[model samples]
Target: MSKIDQFMSGRLRERKDKLSIRNLSTNILPVDFCSNDYLGFARSGELKHLINTNLASMPDYLNGAGGSRLLSGNTKFTEETEQFIAGFHLAESGLIFNSGYDANVGLLSSVPQRGDTIITDELIHASIIDGCRLSHATRFKFHHNDINDLEDKLKLSKGNIFVVVESVYSMDGDMAPLIAISNICERYQANLIVDEAHATGVFGANGRGLINQLKLTDRVFARIITFGKALGVHGAIVLGSKNLRHYLINFARSFIYTTAAPIHNVAAVRSAYQYLNKIDHQLIHQKIALFRNTLKEQNINAIDSESTIQGILFSSNEAAKLAAAHLQSKGFDVRAILSPTVALGKERLRICLHTFNTDEEIISLVNHLQELN
Candidate 1:
């Protein structure tokens, strides 16, 4: 066989004969057990109207940011968005990025200078790991959420240390110990960077995120908040001090090189924030409670998670795919997170709950899982 064909064959063989891959676009309209639109803002007609209203308020707010932010891409809208997000997040300033993945890559790659030490949780998102790989810092991973392990590592670190973690872990649907991690960072005089991707629009009084809800906004060096998951839009912001913002503008390669996001996309994200800023955050809390309550009642031991992500662990990849397929057939769109995404033997059916989901739908989905179990 040709070299290219041989490479593909090796990948297939490495899948261990347990590759439970599926065909694309199997759009089964089931109860939403797989989307990250936790607050229903993705489908909000009100948010859509707000986008139109804002543009109507400024008819000149045109189509695109044409180039990079430092070049032709920077517009009045960019400054306005930064100011709005800064106020909302209670940061000294906010720097917007094309997306959370870009923000993580840029922040991790740029912030950790040569000779600096970067400590990250073992189960951090792939984007962060990739960014860390690109950084010049000596990198290390602590046991997930184990503060003692983090403290031990920090003690040996010799340079400017940066600790990185996510507020709500996406794959496992667990949380980093923000309070404990913050304490450890403080003890070591290290700057903490928190990625609030999965926490936005689900935590805090106005869904500002876990740090804001806990009143720990002032404790971190930077926070990466995504508009995609909970806010249900496209991009993210790095909330930090004005100096950090300025430094990122000058040094963050990803932000400096890429063309800015389209103005309409930016405005839609702003609209989601505006709508969320006025909604009943307690309602989102109630939905999370209801979903978890039903998951428990049905005896599907969804791993401990208070956020939108919940995992139904399976024995193997095939079992995970089968379980997820069963959920789909029963009118739910749960997804199987397989090996490599998670460890072997820990494959899971990742259930994503949403505020739009009714108690009946949550109950029905869990009951179906119960039958399968």
Candidate 2:
């Protein structure tokens, strides 16, 4: 066998031996508890119609974003969509990227110059971590959401300082203490960058995001919003001042080197925001409460979360996987989050509640979980 193939096979075998190997599978489950379509926008017929209407106006010759934005991809629709998002999200300006990963990678890797320092929540998403790695700045991670720990790190940091965090943690489904963190950053003169990936379409007026909802837009240096999550679409944007937008345009390699997302994606994002404004979030909030309450009433030990994303912890990867499989077999789409993604003992069944999910389904899912436990 080729040497490269042998090495790759060996690594995969090691992962399998640990019961932590992952594979892709598709299923048509009866209940929806594993997707990130928090408000059911992904499956909305209305959203599809809106996308179609927007597409109808575009010339038939344009299928792909012909080249990178710097080359040929920067169409008028692209700029308009970004401006619309900025106005809606209460930002001075917005810069669109191909995805949330690209935004974070571009922002983190390029913004912090040499001799600068980055203090991040240890539990922040992998994309942020990767971006930090590519950066020339020194990086330190404090305990997750611990403002005191963050303040201590901030006090010791040298050069320019950037404090990074996620508004709503993707895995744990808990919120960062943004108000307290922002106050501390102000004291330290640190730039605060929030990744609003999971919170974009799940919080604030018209689902602008937690940063906007809390009125901390002015204080934050930048905020990253991804469409694939609650927005139920793809692509992302970095919201900050016009200066920051210009800086990224010139220096952010991920943005410069990558092909821009298609015009169709831009149209969908625009329509998603319009549709998002019309959604009554009260219904979704009620559903989240119902699901959390059901787990409590049944004496199921789930993590404390008011958000739609809830984590039910297990002792090992095997236990979490087994529980997830059993739940899936019962026609629910609950999935296991195993170690490497989370800590070993913190492996879990990550249940995602949705706007379209019925109270009865929530109850049944929780009851089954109780039985499995």
Considering every candidate listed, which one attains the maximal TM-score? 2
Candidate 2 has a TM-score of 0.98
lDDT at 151 for candidate 2?
Answer: 83
Task: In angstroms, give how far residue 28 of model 1 lies from its true place.
Answer: 3.9
What is the C-alpha local distance difference test score of each model?
A: 0.87, 0.91
lDDT of 1 by residue, 1-373 (tens): 9999999988777775668443468585657878898888888888889988977877776577788888888878768988898888888899999999999999999989889999999999999999999899999899999998999889888689999999999988788889888987998999999999998888876888899988889999999999989887899999999999999999899999999987888888778888987788888778778878877776668789888888888889988888888878877888899987899899998888887889888788778888876
Model 2, stretches more than 4 Å misplaced?
59-61
C-alpha displacement of 244 in model 1, angstroms?
0.7
What's the distance in Å from true for residue 148, model 2? 1.3
- Considering only N, C-alpha and C atoms within 3 Å, which residue pairs clash in candidate 1? none
Question: Candidate 1: misplaced stretches above 4 Å?
Answer: 20-23
Q: What is the TM-score of each candidate against the true structure?
A: 0.96, 0.98
